[model samples]
Target: MSDTLEILLTNDDGIDSVGIRAIHDALVEHANANVTVVAPASDQSACGRSISHGGEIGLVDHELGYAVEGTPADCVVAGLAELGPDPDLVVAGCNRGANLGEYVLGRSGTISAAVEAAFFDVPAIATSMYVPVDETPLREIDLSTDDFREARRVTTYLAEYALDAGVFDHAAYLNVNVPTPGKRPAPIEITRPSKRYEMDAEATDGSVTLHDRVWESMDPETIPDPDGTDRRAVAEGRISISPLTAPHSTNHHETLTELAETYHDRVATADD
Candidate 1:
């Protein structure tokens, strides 16, 4: 509506996280956008679209923006409905870890925030960086704003130009994944979410342990994701952008329709 871009920025990580701060600064300083942050006060990673239903969500004013005591989805709702200005765009993340597969679409709070915006008919972008798992566990790795430099650049560029480019005309949101900044700048790739699903569950000693084995093989050579997939692009040191729709797409199933038509008749015949 306004000539100046108004952006609602949020993330799965807390308001004080480096990734969120990096993108927030980039949007204001580089993109010259009016950015309002309504992010979780604490890390809410992997909390997909969960909201505080029929409950008052607490909000605290921060120097950057408002810190919400709820999920990423709550942040978007609060921002759009009450907390901040009506945004031209909603941005989530510069997330610490990559959300690259179709399976992750329903689990990532970072992407969920963007999806929440889409439900409100607002264009959105969700950005994340690929953190490689090495000898040290991912939890032990300390990342700074420098780690998100490339993500910040790409996100800012998209925020500034994508609207004019009509990128969101078809897509509800863009899921963007970037590799950790390299000596050379990573190339951009338009990709689809990888369909690879490698979840494993082990049951022992009356306890079940669930594991997503995909993280163990992020090497370009060993990565099982095919070309043109988000995971492959990020694994190969490239930025991956997947344009996505919010609502679940459906196809007419003639077989299911026929089955439904016969359901009552079949049950009566069986009873007889």
Candidate 2:
């Protein structure tokens, strides 16, 4: 929250990715923050928290930043543990695609980067842009840094205020998604990830094909997202910021507790 902030910037996309470049530039120009960019050498999209561990990780100078030949999570670990200039905030993404819904929390490399930072006890922000899809696959959309204006804007704004405002006091990190660029800037919304699941698989010939039926729900008219969900906010042309915690929660289950208590008795009876 100082006039000059130390920030670690990263993404699921490769170091050459336009999204990360925009983020780096935005932070430097707008937030006046000292930023270090460490990201994958090649696209590591959807590669959750998987790390390279003992495997050798190569780092090379990239036009945008330092490129790590590893997963997004690996980049974070390296940046925090070995990389110089520890950060006050870790910012990930300006991702080409939206990372929405509770289901995506585990699969999205964008969110995974933030989760890794939180484990290191650093407050982080994960920002992504919603790329609309119709009959064609979302990947077909050719995105450039130019496509990430809104995402960069929102990210810079949050970088400036979120820390001083104590946003991280309640949340470990934030999962932010902005609707595609428009004539005017979209409003921000506080939201939670939607609990929506729709995956279908079929065997075609000798191969099994998996289809994500959730894309069908992206249509604003058909989406089942409720008022305060991230999905709903993005669908309605608003920026969605889902405050999230990194650690998994443990809740007491009566059935599991009973099973544990009875297990010894059952084992003794069986032995007898």
Q: On residues 1-272, what C-alpha lDDT tens digit does candidate 1 reach at each position?
A: 66789999999988989999999988999987999999999999899989898878888999999998999999998999998888999999989989989999999999999999999999999999988877897657899988899999899999989999999999999999999898777899999999999999999998999999989888899887899999999988899999999888899999999999999999999999
What clash count goes with each model?
Answer: 0, 0
lDDT of 2 by residue, 76-140 (tens): 99999988488999999978889999989999999999999999999999999988788777667
TM per candidate comes to 0.97, 0.96
Tell me how far the alpha carbon of residue 248 in candidate 1 is from the true structure, in angstroms, after superposition.
0.8
Give me candidate 2's TM-score against the actual structure.
Answer: 0.96
